[model samples]
Target: MTKELLKSTLAELSLAENSTSIIGIKRGIERETLRINNQGRLSSLPHPKKIGSALTHKYITTDFAESLLEFITPATDSAERTLNQLRDIQKYTQARLDNEVLWPMSMPCFIKNQNEIALAQYGSSNVGQMKTLYREGLKNRYGSMMQAIAGVHFNISFPKSFWNRLQVIKGDKTDSQSFISNGYLGLIRNFKRDLWLISYLFGASPALCSSFLEGKESRLPFEKLGKGSLYLPFGTALRLGDLGYTNSAQSALKVTYNSLEEYIIGLKRAISTDSDLYRTIETHSDGSLKQLNSNILQIENEFYSPIRPKRNALAGETPIDALTRDGIEYVEVRALDVNPFSDTGISLQQVYFLDVFLLYCLLNDSPEMDNEEQKISQKNLEQVVNFGRDPSLELIKKGASIPLRKWGEETFEQLALIANWLDTAHGTTHYKTAISELNLCIEDSDKTLSGQYMSALKNSGLDNGCFALELAKQYQVKTQEHQYLELSESDLNNESAHSFVKQKEIENSDEVTFDEFLTAYFK
Candidate 1:
């Protein structure tokens, strides 16, 4: 869709919808800290009791490693509210970490040793056991270092009013759920096409400690910061590049993004599909199951992608089950790095920019991603990740080579137009302000998060450890200085106490043995 078409569509809807566009935003911030003491080595302390159980906590949970904290916020239509909730979570969480500080960046810098990175433990319940088993399978396949990489997930969705208004405008009789799901699919296609730009501008994991490589060579030559720290001179996000998550089996799947049906089918098939090497993974070895099942994915969440379509699943409902029945309620953007400079690892401006970009994706015409286009997109993504800051960086657009700057300007031209529509709908110029900031980054790459990271490292002449830890301490102080309205420190403390009991209840409620559970699931 062109700027004219998007304006025309919004203009028609504004008359009936009263210029209201309800944009619900939910953010989950997962940070993997080294759990260091004053010495800056890895800490081996168990998860703090005051932080709540990783198994049952609604707000705080563990990701790949027990030390990897994932804080999720409830969905809110206001960016300020969502960010406040995130700030409170961080403030409350850091208060509980006895001696540890957040790692401050996407790439973890220091480790005493690899064995110290333990898979997150839930409990003895079947579900908890299954969660650990999935991580074990990941550790078995991808190594612990890859699983330890931390980032941010931004989930957003429009309300039913938007869909109904769109339907009324289109005069389409398709089922409301189908229409919404397909619209989200169109947005996904557009996102995949343009996400490289986001990675280039906002990507922050340009550097990593050599220990993370586990003796493997950097895919590209990396400049050394210190004895163990290495970074690509122009790397944007090494965490999302070739050195990141890679699965030979999934690479072969070639999941399609043409439509919702195709996307769901691909996911379901991948979950059921088996590989000979993975099949050898023993479900029961020492009276405990090894994984959910020996397939390409232990479950649907195992499929690593930069973005995913999501539906809020019911109890005992798989992600696929929820999406299959309820359609895509929202989409999660997983490519964002944890900005080292921000106290919250993200900023209001970044969030606002994302809102406009996502809306732009939805209002645009998204052609299906064919296999050849998929190849090109993947190539484009890798180039930007490794060499995005290079002056001669180019991206492929509609079979023609275009300078990244030129392509970015063309895309921003449309975004500027859409930003105005957003400002009109929200009754604020926040959307426009977001684009204006990014416009500066397009002109000078050094203004970008990635560029700033490199410059920061140079100014201090600090290794990843010294630099990130200093930033981490600075942000921790800033976070403590901030105030929360809806939630208090007392409220988080009470929630933590309740979650501990909930974990025990879940453990006591387990009736089926681990072996029995796996046998039944496989059948």
Candidate 2:
């Protein structure tokens, strides 16, 4: 029944009028990496001034920790161009680093303590202070070690023309924005249901430095490696597992994605409701702010999810407020680990596959997911993360157990159809090529990123940190040797100087005290 609906949708989309809509898909990336010194310890130095002020830089910024760099690309219609922009940003940043190199893996390098991870500073403006304070809240709630783990975020949106065509095909009469938002919600629901496939295929963090688990107790059976690392024999993305950036408290929130209004309401309730667990943590110490608030979430960004529906928020506008005002402008996929094998955090081939998979989500038949279904999806993802390469692993679909490989094969069969559609739209076979390459990973788990990474680690007989550091150094050299692809050195330098001026302008423009600013923001 579901397959028939998907086939019908595809037939409609393949019409000449709707074909251009597929080509109009827009995408951007936010790739995060931690800076480490020669010895593979997290850099304690402040964000590089030569790169630009973290508060005002358009392409480059810090995430959670001062040493963790986030490189963003402008939204473009071509995945190859987006990747080139990412590479240019990384190359520019690499040129500015005095001696630090970007860590190549999703899991962080050796860190003796949480104090070693410094909160990202954004200068003294009220807004900047609030940004830092939010991280402070995250630190108090989830610990800084988890924040140090880096990931690649893929932000994608269908063009307005595509939504219009889709709405017409479905014979929907809702307002344009309402129809578009509903379409994205359906896409999100399907993405959530099938995200485990992403974990299984692209997940790279099979092993991690043992230091990450310091002062924590875990129930997973992790095997020791070289006296300094721990790993699951068949783990895919440990970074997406419990030891990574997970919030146990939010599990009870049961946030649903059925509608824009309901999603916004749930998030607002989380931000406004006080948390008994967090209340005990001091909000201020020695007259300095320790965190933003003692709420279930300090802000909308604090709520963790593998994927999120997003709209670009205006100045002083919260994420939910932006969504409420304009609806979801894009969807952000945060399930991806930083690909250790790529010079950039992610590869173009991976982007191609994502394009097909997300389009599949949009075109596939997605029904409203109840709480039980949500739980099943979560369970499937967890199972894949922990034992994706294990042939015996099975997943639940509609209360029936199916072998993981069988389910993956079925998903690929549908995705290949979408890939062909995308190929025809773009007049190229890259999408189909991506589908064929990744299909092999589904058939043979040993071809997956986790399998390859684990095999390499075992062969090297080195700890996770040592192996990752070697790759980091190699990538740094390669990045430095390559000329800028989509941007020039002059362009980066001018942007850096302009960012400093912009930071000062923002600092000067502040009119209210910090407390007043917070009150106004919350209000």
Candidate 3:
């Protein structure tokens, strides 16, 4: 493709005009405040729910967009090492600050640790250690690299003290407080954060490590990483708890490796050759992915949020968008968890696996399936969800009982082949092990983190929360054992080195309000 054509393709992939993707704020009744009303016998009633935040991340596309993810980019030449050294110092300073400064003035109980995790609740003896493990493991392994560039966190909260002073009489009360509860406010803040994180991580990650890192020269516009420097494609999100958020989950991946036309052909072959990958789904009289008169679009219109909603209330409904733009569209990777148990919410293995999987998706580049084929794919997805580990989930190509695991194995081999190709192209064997790990997951359940957590929960007689806490503790122990031996006494005593690093980070950070943060992010 020509430079101009590639740029336009990526821009179209981002669906720049899809304002329906924006999230909005709304006002409603505050359900949780009812108990407080009874306790105070308040004459003035408070509105139950208040909309507090809106979110959108800008799209980043360029004439050389296809070259973006072809290399890696970092704020510093060695991001991982620099971040680790800085975090080690911060951890030591933070420990002392907690006991000496913050504890005396702020609500110590409410303060989240450096890991951005809350302390353990009462009756839970393991929360403390869980928090400790998360901090230490992350510090020892990846350091604070991701957190630094991830941007500052602005907490959305209600001014409860102001609310308490409101007078009931029309003239007496100022009615200054917003209608939303602090919890909902927090939720909105989290939603905004999630969107931004997903966008940046999704679009930049592949480019940052692969293209920029490998490129001999800088690609950043004006050699600066300004807010609008490039088409910042993946830079927004909307949280939906464990189900995985997708508000900011749109990107136009450059078809540097394959064309949309070619991709469609690949999808057809994938299903046709592997009868196990397809299944029959009854269609409506119109005969498509669904019925025509009944109109899947009607069900979609009523039951789902717009591709992007103009306001927040619309977000309450489902926010799933399936349309693929002309060139680049973000692939929704929906199998992530906050791991309420782990401090960072995910593991290195999971991150590595995701990197490899996404590379496979991009390089192998499956074509879009037709309506009938799409229905079959949906059935395959449902089977993966409901009977994923089941050996016999009844997969059929041309109406034969094919085992699900067998199909899965065959699909993975195709993936592994792509991974091996990428490994050869990149001259990096790291991905081969990652691909092998998936095969291992297929063989031994214990190899995967999810399986390990399940085993821990089942054998330890603990709830999910408690089990996460214990595992965090165990992970911490392992991390300390591995990393502690690598450090020297001299490195520990280098306080000035730590200060210099912190100064650089502060200078780089955007000094802006929550509103400014949102505006700059989406713009």
lDDT of each: 0.81, 0.90, 0.27
| Residue-pair clashes, model 1 | 1
Best by TM-score: 2
Question: Comparing 2 and 3 by lDDT, which wins?
Answer: 2
lDDT tens digits, residue span 170-267, model 2? 99999999988888889999999998999999999989888888857679989999978999998999988888878877887878889999898889
Q: How many residue pairs in model 3 have overlapping backbones?
A: 41
- Write candidate 3's Cα lDDT for 278-359 as tens digits: 1222443764222111211211222111111111223222222122122222222332323323322333344444444433
Runs with alpha carbons beyond 4 Å of true place in candidate 1:
13-18, 22-34, 280-289
Give the per-residue lDDT of model 1 (tens digit) for 289-366: 566667887788889888899998998788888988889998998888888877767788988888878878987878
Looking at model 2, the pairs that clash are none
Looking at candidate 2, the ten consecutive residues that score lowest on lDDT are 282-291
Ranking by TM-score: 2, 1, 3
Cα-based lDDT at residue 96, candidate 3: 25
- Mind sharing the TM-score for model 3? 0.35
